[model samples]
Each structure stands twice: as structure tokens, then as C-alpha cells.
Target chain A: MSDFVQSLRLWFAPGRIKDEGETPDYRFSLANERTFLAWIRTALALVGGGFAVDQFLPDLRWGVRVGLALALLAAGVLCALRAVNHWVRCERAMRRGEDLPVSRFPAVLSLAVAVVALAMVVVVVFGWAGR
Target chain B: MTEVRDPGLQPERTRLAWRRTTLSCTVVAVLAVKVAVHDDITAAGLTGLALSALVWVAFLAVAHRRIRALDAARPHPLSYRGALLAAVCTIALAVCGAAMIW
Candidate 1:
């Protein structure tokens, strides 16, 4: 275990004798990890927002409830998948010394989330007007 | 002594990020439970717990991967476990959130 710690320290710390080819890959990997974390944060926020809806408004209808639930779930799942996919692609690119692939999942998921939110609005409007 | 080749992975930062994410998700799950108390606190709590468990598993997996990858120095530069876990949590949260609204 001590040897493991020493080796890890040697790898991450600057000024260590290392292969020239590996440096760029390391930098990119770190960046990718950071980005992945950011996406996880985003997913957390989305899920939190879903809970917020439930907390703040307790009189919503069945439709609104279903829509919000679906939306939140979709957002979380998509964001998570996208983050991991992005990291894998980035890693692959780094390994091959090529450009990272463009990400479209975020945009698509965002659209879906927005649509669900809009449905919630519609449910509220219709239900309130009827009431 | 033969020079140990660096796989060039950032185990520390990666581990830290996983920890942070797990904590954040757990917090969110707890909040969801809190908000859901009046309507169906039990369901809310259950959902939150489930999400928390998922985050815990993901954290452990990432930590294990980080340790193994760094030790082997195998240049195994691929990570998708975190994102997949996030996806599952998202769906769970959404379902719980929608339940609150109902």
C-alpha cells in the first residue's frame, strides 16, 4: 500500500520523470473527469428540482405529477449517460490523439425536460381554470 | 530499479470528484424526502434512500476503479459508471418528484 501511494504521488505530481506521450492524455483525462463531475452536479440539481416541485406544491393533479416525474427521471438518466459517454469518448480520443466527439444528448434531454415542464404548466392552467 | 510507467490517471481528483458527487446526490435525496413529508413522506424517503444507495455504489465503484487503474498503470482510460448511476438516480428522483405533485 505504501508503494501504491508513492507511485500515485509520482504520477500526479509535477516534475516527475515520465513518458512524453502520457502527459497530454493525463491532462485530458483530468479535464474529462471534471466535466463528468459537473454533469453529475447538474443531474443532482434536476432531481432536486423535481423534489422541490413536490415540496412547494402539494395540490397538483395526477397529470402534472406524472409529467414531472417522467421529466425529472428522463433528465437525470440522460445527463448521467451523457456524462459517462462523453468521458469515454474523450478518453478514446486522447488515447488515439484525436478530437473528442460532439455531445448531443444534453441538448436532446434539455428539450425533453422543457417539454415535460410545459406539460406541467398546461396541467396547472387547465386544472385551475376548471376549479 | 525499472522505472514505473505512469498510466497518467488522476486518481486523487477522480476520487474527490466521485465523493463530491455522491454527497451532492445524497443531499438532494434527503431534501426530496423532506419536501415530500406531508403528502407521502414514506415514498419520498424511500426514493431518496434508493438514490443515496445508488450514489454510494457508484462512489465505491469509481474508487475501486481509480485504485486499480492507478496501481496497474494500465492506461485503461475509460469511465462510464458514474454517468450510468446518475441516469438511474435521475429517473428515480423524477418519479418521486412527480409523486409529490400528485
Candidate 2:
């Protein structure tokens, strides 16, 4: 628990980066930040979807509805968590004149989206048929 | 901190990304606010509403500062503080959203 708090502290400590790393072109860091923001938007979208699932699918099996919503909410949390880690790692790599770490998030997130889309499609099909 | 003669448009593009992301966050936050308003305003719901707006403001502020730094030709690596701020805000949003939902 202490370690986790420490890690959180470290993550939040912006000034620690003051003098580290060889200063590269400003564009690199800007691009990295843009990528981080994009992930955050993705997470926010998932949360919005969670609300939509909970609200619109009144006829959905409560179990399935809740499960799907929870999955989406959890995925959003994962994206936020990963966004920081990726940003920091990428920043550190740039500072050290090392290769930026490859991100696997896009693939994972796409798969999650596929799962959600498929679930929604099934739900829609049934809803249309029942109507 | 030497200025690179050819900084290109990447910084501008990145700033644009920040603007888009913050805009999306704000929209979602407003949606959360709508949900809270429709329901009885619980503490969690209100907190989510406030935090959502706060996150957007904070993100814009930091992005602006960083972009300014870029424009000023001080090519510092992106601040870990800014990254952490984004992370904390984004995660707080998720947590507050859960509070509203749950």
C-alpha cells in the first residue's frame, strides 16, 4: 500500500522532470502528450457508453446489462491508468536517448471495443425482433 | 535548450489533440451532470459533475502552458507533472463516474 502511494506520488510529481533527459525537439513531447490525451478521450467515451448501456437497455437482462456496463467502466479505468504509465515511459525513454516504448494499448482497446460493439449489436437485434 | 530551426507543425497538431480531448471530456462531464440533475443530487453525483468541469479546465491550462513552452523554444521534455495531472484527473473522472453510476 505504501509502495502504491509512493508510486502515485511519483506519478504526480511533475517537477522531478525539470532537468532530466537530453532536450529533444519540442514536437516529440507534444506528439506524446497528444497521444496521451487521445487515450483519455477514449476512456471518457467508455464511461459515457456505460451510462448509455445502463439507461437505454431497460429491457436488457439486468445481469448482462450490469456486467456490460461494469466491463466498460473498468475498461475506462484501465485506459486512464495506462495512459499515465505510457506517457511517463515514453517521456523517460526520450530523455535517456532510448527508443520509446511500444504501446500495446491500441490493440487491446480495439478488442474491447469489438466486444462491446458485438454485444450491443446482439442486444439491438433482439430488441428489434421483440418489437 | 537550443532552439531547433525547424520545429514543424507537430506541436500545433499535438495542441489540437489536447483541445479535442478536453472537449470530449467536457462533453461527457456535462452528460454526467445531466444524469445527476435528473436523479436526486447525491454527493457522489455532484462531485462527479464538479470534477468533470475541473478536469477540463485543468487540462486546458496545462496544455496551454506546455504549448507556450514549446512556442517559446524551450524544448523541455513534457512535464511528468502534466502527465500525472492528466492521469489523476482522468482517473478521478472514472472513479467519480462510478460513484454516480453505482
Estimated TM-score for each candidate: 0.60, 0.79
Question: Candidate 2's residue-wise lDDT over B1-102, tens digit each?
Answer: 565533576656666776787677776666667655665877766767777678767867876786676554435556677776776766666666666666
Per-residue lDDT of model 1, residues A2-116, tens digit only: 7335434533442332332343545456667778778877877777766666556667765566557556755765676566556555655565566767756767877877887
Which consecutive 10 residues in model 1 chain A have the weakest lDDT in total?
Answer: A11-20
CAPRI-style grade of the A/B interface in model 1: acceptable
Best by lDDT, which number? 2
Where does model 2 exceed 4 Å of error? A1-21, B1-7, B39-44, B67-70
Please give the distance, in angstroms, between residue B89's alpha carbon in candidate 1 and its true position after superposition. Answer: 5.6
Per-candidate RMSD, Å: 10.6, 3.9
* Model 1, C-alpha of A65: deviation from truth (Å): 1.9
State the lDDT of candidate 1 residue by residue for B27-100, as single tens digits: 77667557555545475556655655564466556555654664443334333443455555555555555555
Q: What would the per-residue lDDT of candidate 2 be over residues A1-131, giving only the tens digit for each residue?
A: 67346436557575554457676666777777778888888887887777677776778877788788778888888998888877776776777798877767789889989988998899889878998
C-alpha RMSD over true interface residues, model 2: 2.0
